[model samples]
Target: MTELSLRTRESFDAVMRKYADMVYRLAYARTGSTFDADDILQEVFLRYIRADKTYNDEEHRKAWLIRITVNCTRSFAASAYNRHRDLSEPDENAGAEDPALKAAETKSDVMKALLELPEKYRTAIYLFYYEDMSVAQIAKSLGTTETNVKTRLSRGRDMLKEKLKGVEFDV
Candidate 1:
């Protein structure tokens, strides 16, 4: 049993290393802030460690992670603290030297336009373009139909195109 537990721990660590970037990017895309994304990333992994459920395969695990990430970001967005907080107020903890935020700020115009979109649209676009999730897969992850996902992609594309007409980035 000890050996089995040790293997489980190793597996968890491996999953963290493998999925950390993907999870972080998803969280960042959803929250539009480095600090919020990092918080969501940590919470998602913590829940992963504590959850009683198990994943049958890599796809299952990835889907599970994405679902949890979306939930975390949504909860954060809906929280009373966030709802009452001032949007223009700077994060007291995110000092000028935060490289993660600096990197987020340096994203291209296409990325900037994507961030300007509504949360659902940003998520659909991110999952489709950056994460390479299919429309059906995104629909499953988002608890919506494939048709809804396609609609979101179409609307998001229109918004992006309008915002990025002169920008030279592939859609």
Candidate 2:
């Protein structure tokens, strides 16, 4: 177990180095602001450090971290909404300067459309497309059946297509 501790620390460091950007992106997609996403990332790692010992396996640990991140983002959104008495708006600079910024801008329009969706559909779409989770994984993460995830994904995509019909894309 002593060796495992060292290996876990090494593995954790490697994972953070490799996937930190991915985590931030996921958090940003969920929270819509770099500042809030930064906070969420920190909170996710803190939770990971204090996580249960049973998640000794790497895959289990990664899933646990993602779950914590998603939960924290949802909680933050709820609290922000309660405090402001309005839906938190997406940051205007949500997509700024990546090579794919133009494509992302189109997607951001879709995301804005997604913001109009009920939380269930919004989360399903974000997890399925942006986070690339499978329907089964999304269902497990959301505590729903895979069939429900599929239904939500379908509905969300249709809504996005409808909302984006007239949006002009630069590219």
Candidate 3:
């Protein structure tokens, strides 16, 4: 990259403020480690600062950011560093309260059930219900077909339901 000055620091700070938590959560979900997720967040924003790219709209920018996050997390997961390490307890309290999911359940219960899911299934569920992405959009972000995204969501939901059975929480 040519000197790392694609945008003003102020603009980059704005982007970080808006997307940092989302990026962090995505990284955490993939790695199951807070340290690695924080590292990925820094690397993603650093790359964004150095890349010379244009976006037509906010949605496009968000899509690009999500793509970068997914790629970064995948690379992190494949690294020798990750391969040699046992995944740690998830370090963040992830998931938002869903009025549609009211129950006699705590956030930790939902988070624990979510974490018990396989990586792909957890990611699919996060993007669908939490990120509010459509199946087509998720397919595009995940570089899979819509059918595959739908299937992942279905399987993910089933897994979550099984994991959270009798917890009074709805998926």
Candidate 4:
């Protein structure tokens, strides 16, 4: 039993390492701050560790972690912490210290538009387009209906189009 538990712990750690960056990116996208993202990342993993034994299997575990991260971000967004912070200001130095960083920053305006969106729409857009998740997968991960995910995706795309009309992106 001890050996079995040890193996499970190892497996969980391996999975966390593989997907941590993606999880952090999703959190960062939602929160628009490294500090918040880091907090969410830690909370997500902590939840994973405390999860039930039924939370087995790599795919399900990954989805569960993402769902928790999203939920945590949403909760944080609604809290007083978010009320005091300004969401309009983009982090000029975030992931932008090199040439590649400069290239990525070119899309800062678009990301800002995305950040300004309602949380539901932003989550759908990020999961669908940025995270490259399918509607069904997103629905499963988010515990929503596929039709709802599709609706959100459509609305999000329309919003993005409207917001990015005058903006040109290199990529």
Candidate 5:
């Protein structure tokens, strides 16, 4: 109704449109389950909206979202419900040809190998390569040292190379 509210609404919509895919992809990369990723995406935005925090720039806002995503995924993975789930149950759609997943998995072999890496390395690699973020940016987002991020990236690349030895995928 008011000008201030209208401006806030427009900004919120813009932020959601700009970063929704990035948040979802990061969540999916972390959880390996679309359902969980969806939930994490919702949680991250909810926090963002509720925090009502101001950012210094677009990069700061992006980094904040990344940090929230990482925290939300960690919370989900550590939840009692997740811990007690039946891990033996087979993924129903594991062999299904899902078009959405097909589109997302541009280089299937590379994605598969990337998912196999440790979470620390996987997060680093995803932010660096997939999100086109610098090591310094990732360090700030993850609240870690740049040296640590570099180490993770180096180790992640090596792990992917080993896993996709016969494949034509590059890390």
Candidate 6:
């Protein structure tokens, strides 16, 4: 095709490579389902390709992607199909005999506890801790005030502490 089309395609590919993992991780953290996360990833990038907005910088582009990913995950979770889907309980076994396996088990427990949290709290915790995003950045990405992000982080941490009381989670 034209040079402009080729350049645009290259730019999109680079953007996808740079942010795909971040988008997938955020989506997975929000939904607690790999399938849903994959679907959201595709949708988020589709939206990115369709958007006509101009980014001020790479950080602005990243924030825009984060916002889109969050919105798409929320919409996907709220869809009638997802609402009617059945969620199977995770296996409740600590069958780890080795140190590495035990560590895996601990991580599994922490993920379970994280998944048990409310959407707002989980999103706040994930963005803050896992993504290394500041409260101000999270607030802008989530379309909330920094105060609200701080409150959510505090409440979410308290909830996580309570949920993982017997576990050795450092978060």
Q: Tens digit of lDDT per residue, candidate 1, span 48-160?
A: 88873566666878898899999999899889888777868776665746555565459667667887899899999999998899999999999999999999988998888
Clashes of 6: 0
Off by over 4 Å in 2: 1-7, 52-58, 80-84, 88-117, 166-171
Clashing pairs in 3: none
Using TM-score as the measure, the top candidate is 1
Tens-digit lDDT track of model 4 for 38-130: 888888877777764454555666677788888888788777756565756564455544432343358576777787677778888888777
Error of 3 at 91 (Å): 12
Candidate 5: the clashing residue pairs are none
Q: lDDT at 115 for candidate 3?
A: 67
Instruction: Estimate candidate 3's RMSD in Å.
Output: 7.4
Stretches of model 1 off by over 4 angstroms after superposition: 1-10, 86-101, 104-107, 166-171
Tens digits of lDDT, candidate 5, 76-104: 98898776666676655567664445645
Question: What tens-digit string does per-residue lDDT give for candidate 6 at 40-89?
Answer: 99999999888855676777888999999999998997898766655663
**Candidate 3 per-residue C-alpha lDDT over 29-121 given as tens digits, one digit per residue, 9 for 90 to 100:** 765556677789999998888774766666667777888989999888788766665556432333544322233134467776776688888
Better of 3 and 5 by lDDT: 5
In model 1, residue pairs whose N, Cα or C atoms come closer than 3 Å (at least 3 residues apart or on different chains), thus clashing, are: none
Model 3 poorest ten-residue lDDT run: 96-105
By TM-score, the better pick of 3 and 6 is 3
Candidate 1: residue 123 lDDT (0-100): 99
lDDT preference between candidates 3 and 6, better one: 6
**Arrange candidates by TM-score, highest first: which order?**
1, 5, 3, 6, 4, 2
Candidate 5's TM-score reads 0.81
lDDT of 6 at 98: 36
